[model samples]
Target: MAKTKKSARATLPPSIGKVLKRLHHPLDVILLCVRWYVAYSLSLRNLEEMMAERGLEVDHSSVHRWVIKLVPLFEKAFRKHKRPVGKSWRMDETYVKVRGQWKYLYRAVDKAGNTVDFLLRAHRDKAAARRYFEKAIDRNGEPETITVDKSGANLAALEALNADRPTPIKVRQSKYLNNVVEQDHRAIKRIIKPMMGFKDFRCARIILAGIEVMHMIRKGQMQDDGIARNPAEKFYSIII
Candidate 1:
């Protein structure tokens, strides 16, 4: 019998081998840099200085690359372990500056403050709303009811989605009802404010993903025993 070749992803452990290959630093050090950058409101230069204090002479650019490259790996590994969020969702959009240009950041959180999903778009129209809803539903499943602000664009998007699917999702448009997601944006905004602004959209998206993942961890959204010494260590165990 002929032997079947194993796919690269299956052969490697959790896709880290591909990203970490040729790196001289230890996995723990690399993970530390990533964790600090994501979990704290620190700039790349601040992280570099912190690493230097620990006797690691890594550049800020290296830390930037680690975040941009490794965050998706961590997110992909952690998704299967994420606890299922509530079917009732609160949806909202916030504006963020990227390279002096404003972009709409669409975010959805369940009733319990668990982040469902997020999308970045250049506009806040019906098309953008529809795309955001589609991505959120595709990842977290369709919500039983979605609470949003009194935006006609959001209403149209939900209606369009309901028209195509067998299971219709109820839409509620009340500012008070959607406060959960609105409040959730503050953590991200606080972090972004220190950086002045992102240089480009790609970097903004990557950094935002890292920041959101860190927020999810803090909220206990990722699967972990309460016995770990710390959150960063708990995350390290899952990835490695």
Candidate 2:
């Protein structure tokens, strides 16, 4: 009787039980939609139509709700298992439109082109750059060197951080060295271009994070414990 009772329990991971508790759809179905949305360039309506063809009637609004609710959790989980990046860094900022206004997305990649961290801010000044550096350093530890383009704000931010450190970080300003990171931005920009722009800042931040997480997964950034076979498997592995 004990063996039968144990076997009858749901096989879903306990960590996500509370998150998906009230959802009517099966776990695989919900996660598939979320994964497809972020990993590919599919919109909510596109996912809705795809699911409909599979004989399931899921609305686009519900999928949007799922993304808004679950993506942050997915990001949190991904961070815990993210692999350490190289010490030499390349940092840059890109433009993201939120509410018809341009916001700055600060992103960094290691010397090997692995993503270090990303932050979105409303401004492109020294203060915004400093905050992004602080967040990245807090999560990823100090880098030996950071190469940036001829951005005064980025230079100022690194200078401010160096002031508080015992060993100063080497700062290099070269448009050519930063080309790797600038080229990396295209993968993210390509996915978001179809959406035109984000409706609000909060949504933009969350969705952008989801996209980054997927990008990281594609680059084999997550420490998968040797269990996942591909990017999709690696993505689903993070939640468990």
Candidate 3:
């Protein structure tokens, strides 16, 4: 009998494995589409034209599907690599229209201009503010100080949360102090403005996640190098 040799098998990371099934396009091509979609303000139609110019025939709907399906995977992979945010944070809420109805987008950023987190809500009251604050703290840990405008809802939420802590987090109500996070909103706003508005809330949330992840990547907040030498490779390496 001939001797039998054993062969080693390659494994895919869970994050990428889930998305690899039923994916027909090459990994590089998929990554390029995703990168352009999120990293730039290009619309789906624009991406379709650009891909056509490159000798690749892909529909805008396909690009939209890629963004919807892959963004969560990318965000999960990138979360493991994010740098610890600064101790102080600036928090604010902005309005976004979904299906012609206005919704609140609660966003927070550290003093260094790195995004902490964001949430979409139907209201901008104390309950909504508390929910946003709780989610941000849970994800990024509690900040030493939070700067906000004198929104009563925000102040109330801080007070409610502080009541339970042995050492309360400081809240600074100053319009000037929160300029960093306020200005940080422009990147996301610019992306959304081009699309006019999302058709539904779920779709809005999914797309927003992808957009924010791209913003974080561009800001050099998602890698050990503090800057991705090759973004495509860096993104692809997350799963492979």
- Best by the lDDT measure: 2
Model 1, CA-based lDDT: 0.83
Cα lDDT, all candidates:
0.83, 0.87, 0.82
The best candidate by TM-score is 2
* Model 1 steric clash total: 0
lDDT of 1 by residue, 1-240 (tens): 011223322344746777877566666677778888878878889988998898989999888888888888777777777888899999999999998999999999999999999988988899999999999888888789999999999999999999998979988999998888888999889877777788989888888887888788788888756666466755665565
- Worst window of 10 by summed lDDT in candidate 3: 1-10
**Candidate 2 CA-lDDT value:** 0.87
Of candidate 2, the 10-residue stretch with the lowest lDDT total is 1-10
- Each candidate structure's TM-score, on Cα atoms with residue i matched to residue i, is 0.90, 0.93, 0.89
Clashes of each: 0, 0, 0
User: By the TM-score metric, which is better: model 2 or model 3?
Assistant: 2
Distance from true location, Cα of 237 in model 1, Å: 2.5
Cα shift from native, residue 29, model 2 (Å): 1.4
Q: CA shift at 75, candidate 1, in angstroms?
A: 1.3
Instruction: Return the candidate ranking by lDDT, descending.
Output: 2, 1, 3
lDDT of 2 by residue, 40-120 (tens): 888788899999999999998888777877899899989999999999999999999998989999999998999999999
